[model samples]
Structure formats: structure tokens, C-alpha cells
Target: MDITQDQTLDITSFFCPMTFVHTRLALDRMTSGEKLVLILNDGDARRNVAASAQALGHVIEADESLPGNRARLVIRK
Candidate 1:
């Protein structure tokens, strides 16, 4: 079953290290088992955020492409 997101973090305006920085901050604020939908720009933002979250032992529920150069990432903290 798909877990519902408890919050959203849009880091489309950020890049590289800052992308994961904000993502980690938001995850820190969430309780265990809660989910978050993170919106990011394509390419580096997409790869960086997802990889960083995974490295931290977070679960990635979904990773999909949006219209234009954006991506929708669902993470469970």
C-alpha cells in the first residue's frame, strides 16, 4: 500500500548541496513513518535529493517526472 504524505517540501529553487540540505531539514522535522512529497528540478536536484535521503536510510516511495523540467519525489522518514 502507498503511504500518504504528511507534508511537502519544494526545493525547485535550490541546487546541488542546498537541495539535500533543505530536504534533510524537513525530514528532521517529521516524525518517524511520516511521508513527505518533495518537488525538485530535473537532473542534479532530482538525483542529489533522492540519493541523500536514501543514504540517510529514508524510504523513497515514488520518483516521477512532472511537466517541464521538474520531478516529484515521495520520501518516508
Candidate 2:
């Protein structure tokens, strides 16, 4: 299903824990069923953010690769 995001977070300049930290903070501010479009760098940030968000019980609607070494994670809170 296609989800329309309520917010967008660009964490391409952040690393590990901070990446997820910021994403989590953003999710926390939103209500249930709200969508978040998170743009993060590839590698650990991508992997860890997805894992952490799932661990928090949020739904990962989609994960897409960008032109550069980056990815977009679509999450539902």
C-alpha cells in the first residue's frame, strides 16, 4: 500500500545512534498512523534506523535507494 508521509527527516549527515535518535524523536512527536519519510546515508545508518524503528513497533512501509549512497525509509508511527 502507498502511504503519504506527514513529515520528512533528513539524517544523511548523522551517524549510528544519533541517526536513530533523531528519527525516534520525530516519530515520538507524531500521532499513531502518521507516516515519516526518513532520508539517511547508506550502511549502518540505514540498517540501524530501520531496525530500531521496527523494534519500537513502528511499521516500515518502504525502503528505497537514492541516487547517491543514501536511502529513504518510509515509516508509520
Candidate 3:
């Protein structure tokens, strides 16, 4: 299914737990099946965020790395 994102969040400046914390909060604020696009920096933010989201059973639609060691992550809540 093609899911259109209902919101976008930038957790690039956030670190570790806060990265996934903010992302999780955003997803919680959204309704079911709604898509959320997140902007996250590479390294721990990237690895932890994906792991955190997946652990919560949120469906990951896309995880594409961009320039400047950043990535665009799409999650379905």
C-alpha cells in the first residue's frame, strides 16, 4: 500500500534515546496507519531509531540515506 505521510519530524539534532524518544512520541500522537517521515543523522541516531521503532512494532516503510550522513526514515503507525 502507498501510504502518504501525515507528518514529518526532524530528530537530527537529537541524540540516542531522545532521537527515538521524539520519534516515538510523534508516532504516538498520530493515528493508526498514518505515515511519519523522520529526518535523522547517521551513527547512533540512525541505528537506534530504526531499532527502537521496530521494537515497538511500527512498520518501517523506507530508510534512505541522504547526503551529509543523514537519512530519511518513513514509519507507519
Candidate 4:
């Protein structure tokens, strides 16, 4: 199930370095305790996006499968 009603950042078609890079930049702009909802449609992003977020001192609190191989992730700073 998808989590709606949060700020969403869609990086579906973005590739590797860009995927992680954009996620980081977006997260950086968010305030502490605020949530960031990411919709990643690429396969490579599903493989490593969470790690990138964790490495940046952020916590990927939840991940739920969305339709069409897309994943919905929530991160808290």
C-alpha cells in the first residue's frame, strides 16, 4: 500500500548516481522530523536507494511495494 498525504519526490526515471544524488539533495532541504516520500520506479534505485539514505544519517522508516515495480519509501531526518 502507498502512503499518501506526505511530501513526495518522484525520481522514477532517474538513474544511479543521479537517483542517489537527487534523493540526498532533496532530503537535505527537509526539516528534521519531517517525512519525505519517495517514489522510485527504476530497478537500480530499489536496490540501493535506502542505503544511500541511511548513510546520510537519515532513516528509511518504511518501504511498501507500489504498482508496476515502483516502490514507496518514507525517510525521516
Candidate 5:
């Protein structure tokens, strides 16, 4: 899919619920079909944030691992 992200959210400093919370807030502010480039830390935050966004009916366009235990999650809201 061609993912054109409209916004970016960096939640690398957060964990768990906060990670998803920030992502959700970013999504909530966007229109349908718009995309977000979410930069998150590895481990729990990356996993849970993607799952939670998907559970809320958003689309996970891409999930790429960056250097230093980080990840970039592209979400369509």
C-alpha cells in the first residue's frame, strides 16, 4: 500500500498505556484515511501501541525497526 503519513508522533520516552494513549490522541485529531508516522521505543511500547491502534480499527501500514532499539509504526486513522 502507498502510505502517505500526515503527522508524526514520537513516543519513545513513554511506555505501555501512555504509548497507546499518545498514539490514540494523535489519531483522534486526524481524519479518516490520514496517516501517522509513530516513532516508538522497542519492547512493550512498540508491541502494545500497534496492537491497540489496530484494535481501535486503525490500519498499520508499516512497522520498521530503527537503530538503537527503536521502531517506526505507520498508522492510518
Candidate 6:
């Protein structure tokens, strides 16, 4: 349940499809009770990432904005 201590993937520089692609792949590698943190830039990721995660049944643990137009999303698998 504590995701901050688990695996994290930073895809801030990656755009649209690649961001979702990498997120999906990372989530697949985690165990059922495990979690992953995804760092994304502002824009498409805000919409697409969460939508994709919801569709795949992954839990969106936390979503917050960081300084300078970045967002941090914690997801569970």
C-alpha cells in the first residue's frame, strides 16, 4: 500500500503515446500488490495517463503538481 517505497519510473521527457506505453509496461512488471511512480510533464499526460491507468484497472494512488509545470503520479498494480 505504501507506494513511495516501491519502484518508480520517470518519464517526464517522454510525450503522449510513449509515456503511456512506458507506464503500461512498468505496471505489467509489478506484482499485483505492488506500485509504481510515474513522473510526467504537463499537458497530454495529465489526461491520457490517468485515463489509460483507469482503463487497465490500475489504482491511481496520488496525483499532484510539482514545481515548474510537472506532475507526479503514483499508481498501483
Give the winner by TM-score.
2
13 in model 4: Cα distance from truth in Å? 1.4
The digit string of per-residue lDDT tens for model 1 on 1-77 reads 46577998888988889999899889999999999999899898898888889999999999999998999999998
The candidate 2 region of ten consecutive residues with least summed lDDT is 1-10
Candidate 1 deviates by what RMSD? Answer: 1.6
Among residues 3 or more apart in sequence or in different chains, the pairs in candidate 1 whose N, CA or C atoms overlap within 3 Å are none
Clashing residue pair totals per candidate (backbone < 3 A): 0, 0, 0, 0, 0, 0
lDDT of 5 by residue, 1-77 (tens): 46677998888888888898888888999999999998899888988988888999998989999999999999988
Which runs of model 5 end up more than 4 angstroms from their true locations? 1-3
Residue pairs in clash, model 6: none
- Candidate 6 residue lDDT tens string, 1-77: 34553788889888889999999888888898687888789778867998899898988888888888888888878
Model 2: lDDT of residue 19: 98
Best by lDDT: 2
Q: State the lDDT of candidate 4 residue by residue for 6-75, as single tens digits.
A: 4788999888888888888887888888788888974678668988888778888888789888998888
TM-score of each: 0.93, 0.94, 0.92, 0.84, 0.93, 0.90
> Of models 3 and 6, which has the larger TM-score?
3
Q: Candidate 3 — worst ten consecutive residues by lDDT sum?
A: 1-10
**Residue 41 lDDT in candidate 6:** 90
lDDT of 2 by residue, 1-77 (tens): 46687999999988888999899899999999999999999888998999999999999999989989999999999
Task: Name the regions of candidate 3 deviating beyond 4 angstroms.
Answer: 1-3
Q: What's the CA RMSD for each of the models?
A: 1.6, 1.3, 1.9, 2.0, 1.6, 2.0
- Residues 1-77 of candidate 3: C-alpha lDDT, one tens digit per residue: 35588999988888888898899889989998999999999888988888888899998899889899999889988
Order candidates by TM-score, high to low: 2, 1, 5, 3, 6, 4
